[model samples]
Target: MAIISKLTIISILVISFALAFLAFYLISPLSKEQRKEQIGEIISQLINFVLFLWLAKILLNLQLFVQDPLAVLAYPSNSEAFYLATLFTGVLLFYKRRQKKITGVLLAHSFLQVFLAASFFYEFIQFVWRDNPFSFHYLIVFGVLLALFHLLQGRAKPQNQISIVLAVGAAGFFAINFMLPYLTLFGYIMEPWFLALLLAACFGLLIKDPQDEPHSETH
Candidate 1:
């Protein structure tokens, strides 16, 4: 049963990654260099998260891991691991962007759009396979936001528009989660931290100069 559960989770993650990749490929309008940089940063973050998860598991079961290093792989992740990974990834991304002299607002705008599209695809799949109404609700919301994003992409500066959309969408998502406690992923309660982060990013983007050219070409 444990092995089966592990394999199921792995399969789901694989499918999600594939869907996210396809979504990013289709929706992004960045130059090759910008795309490459964003993709590399994303992949690095994922790797860092996995490493953090492993470290967390090992620390939690030090004796067991010491006896058998492979045991760490079998350990289930807890909220601690996720929180740590989120913090680590956030700081790492900020540091790397600063080091590279990358504009924070531009990076946030691009990533938020990609994230919304990828999240929509992932939820759509879950809605189809699990028949979850919550997933369907989120899918609709994300789809609408994505449509709005694309519509405004060519006409307006994306930093402000995307930030506003993300802030609004995050508020809506929070409301839905509050009203529907049963909306969960894999029996784990979804945290509102993602929404908080989105709001923070939105505020950050809002303060940036609107006249500055974004890192990527929108058209």
Candidate 2:
């Protein structure tokens, strides 16, 4: 019974994630082939992040992991692990881009859309099914991000849109996290340092010339 319940939960989560990706793919403005490739890359990046997160969680508690591996594995990942995972993933992304496996603009655009879509869906599910009070705040937050990104698509340069959105999102998160002591998304409270790093990364990406990006949009 326990095994079956775990399997069911995993299956539901997979389906929900697939639906989120599908929603982004359907509404994307990129060409069909471009959209497909971008979504594929997004999935690959997400997998990389998850794998790093798992590894970081184990490493964060070396003593516990050495004593009781099973118990350590069963425990939830902490904020420090989350930050380490994000840092490792960011490094991996930089390496991939250097290898010409990733394009700056396309990755930025695709990732933002998929992130917002998945976040909104997760918050909606939490609000409706779990009656989480924080979920409503997150839903409104993500909705505003979606609307802001859409508004920027027309007014802002394609190269600048992602940086602008990322900056704004990080700032918003910082404010919310400061005001709400129990700030959490997907059961992990974000550390301020992570948001600060995101802002720094956004600034770094902002300086790149879009023309140099392989998948850069001229329009």
Q: Which of the numbered candidates is closest to the native, going by highest lDDT?
A: 2
Model 1, clash count?
0
lDDT of 2 at 121: 76
Q: TM-score for every candidate vs. truth?
A: 0.78, 0.86
Q: lDDT at 187 for candidate 2?
A: 62
Please state the error at residue 189 of candidate 2 in Å.
0.7
The whole-model C-alpha lDDT of candidate 1 against the native structure comes to 0.68
lDDT of 2 by residue, 92-163 (tens): 888877776777766877788778877877777778876777778778888888888888865776567787
What are the per-residue Cα lDDT tens digits for candidate 1 across 34-115?
Answer: 7767666666667887887677767777898889988666778776666566666667766766575656666666676666
Superposed by TM-score, candidate 2 places the C-alpha of residue 101 at a distance from the truth, in angstroms, of 1.4
Whole-model Cα lDDT of every candidate shown, in order = 0.68, 0.75
lDDT of 2 at 98: 73
